[model samples]
Target: MIEIVDAVAWLVDLEVETVRTDAVQSFVKQETVFVEVTTNDGNKGIGYSYTIGTGGTSVLAMLREHLLPRLIGADAALVERVWFDLFASTRATTVGAITSLALAAVDTALWDLRCTRAGEPLWRLAGGFRPKVPLYDTEGGWLHLSTDELVAGARASQAAGWPGVKLKVGKPRLDEDVERLTAVRDAVGAGMDIMVDANQSMTQAEARRRAAAFEPLGLSWFEEPLPADDVAGHEALARGTAIPIAVGESMYSVAQFREYLARGAASIVQVDAARVGGITPWLKVAHTAEAFNVHVCPHFLMELHVSLVAAVPNGRYVEHIPQLRAITHGQMRIEDGHAVAPDTPGIGIDWDFDAIDDRRVA
Candidate 1:
């Protein structure tokens, strides 16, 4: 048995490369919390989780004080058992962001160890349904971009052979949103898929109204139209509109995803590995969505999500929002229009520790 011998956690703040804006929030710096686990046999694995701007320190504290300690001397091979034990130990904080984020750090590290020891890439070890998934560019779709800019970005993505581009919605007036989407549709023609995200800034009534207005544009999906907890609202909205309701980026547990699926609220699941407590529950959410016949297009963490989307049969497009280029040694590879999963062993991310050490804030 490979016994866990040591664990360490730290914080790194990566500044956003561009001004990322949506209806509700602006892109702030990424507060990345990384955890490294070393086994008694001298093998090491690394995992990480992050917050948009806040709570990184809290996640780090949770790992340093509560989660990491529990990993010591535990069997590294039993990743799922370790996950459950940690969840049980942190029962009081179960199903919340801080605990979930903290748990993700440890859980992903264990997965890294498992994949490395097995001599398999994470995508193959996790599921191996495919080695590549289609990509959609979100970097040029910020809500702040003008219609001309949006059109230009969409045209650029089309020129690059990308299948889709996501645009941000939630303007003060519904006509403005329609006008922007109309221009992109007209510019990109009918071949390129167009998606829109409201970032959970709309009321059910507003969402319904916009969904009705945007339906004629032939959008791929409407993401985070309303807040995440409003299952009933989402259900009503889904029934009232032809556009697919995409959610799960804000959710923190598999139970939450199950609730959304059971109620038929969400059609596309955008489950974030970090937000859902790492690869363990992330897979559970994907399989759950699959059981419901829903497709998953995860939010952010393209570096990790590329492998995961490649791992599952029901996986769909991966949103392209590059935030890790400043700290990671390599970037996610895109071929033709799809993001390719890393063929390397472990989590597939080549961490540039020197850059991480330079960015360390806590």
Candidate 2:
């Protein structure tokens, strides 16, 4: 039996490389909580989860005070069982951000152990549907960028052969958002896809208005126009607009996704593995979205998400937001505008432990 002998958790803070602004908030530092698990036989796996800025200490506390202790002596290979047991143990706090984030760190670590034991990379072990997914650039489309900058960024992505670029919407005025997106659309022309995200900053009425305005621009999707919990609002907006309503990054559970898909509230599902409580449930959400014929374009964590997106049939596009460069050895390889899944055994991120130690706060 590959029993978990030890589990350790810590915190690392990664600074944003550039100023990332969207409709609701500025890009604050990433507060990452990493979990490392070791089996009795000496095999080990690493897993992690993150918050945009706050909640790192809480996630770490949850793991150290509750989750990691339960992991000791548990069968590391039984990934699903471990996930369920841990979730059940934390029933008081189950299905929320802090608990889910803590659970994610532990769950992903177990998956890493499972993949290592199987001697296959996570993409193949998870499903291995495809080794590459087409890329979409989000790094260039911050709401703070001027119209000229947005145009230049979109043009740069187009020149590089990337199929899509996402722009941040929800400006003070409807025309301001329109003006920026119009410039990018004209700059990138008809070949490259243009996606817009409102970051869940607008009300139902405002979203409806923007959807109508953005329809003529030929947008690929309008993401998170309303809060994630506003299912009724999303359903109405989705029904009314021709542009797809993309959502799910802010959601914390599989049930949330089910509600969205069952009601036809969302067209593109942006399941963040970390936010969804790691790969175990993340896969469930993706498969559920598939049943509804919704394509998943997962939000953030590109390194971990690349393998996951490549593993499923209905995986659409991987959002390109580079957040791991400072504490990781290398970047996710982009070949011909598609993000390639790493073939390395276990979760494929090459962590720089030295860098992590330097940045460790807890």
In order, candidate lDDTs are 0.94, 0.94
Candidate 1's displacement at residue 206, Å, is: 1.0
lDDT string for model 1 (62-106, tens) is 999998998899999999899999999999998899999999999
Report the Cα lDDT for residue 78, model 1.
93
- The TM-score of candidate 2 is 0.99
How would you encode candidate 2's per-residue C-alpha lDDT over 33-139 as one tens digit per residue? 99999999999999999998999999999999999999889998888999999999989997899999998999889988899889899999999999999999998
Worst 10 residues of 2 by lDDT: 182-191
Model 2 / residue 194 / CA error / Å: 0.7
TM-score of 1: 0.99
Model 2: residues >4 Å from true position, as ranges? none
Specify the poorest-scoring 10-residue window by lDDT in model 1: 321-330
lDDT of 1: 0.94
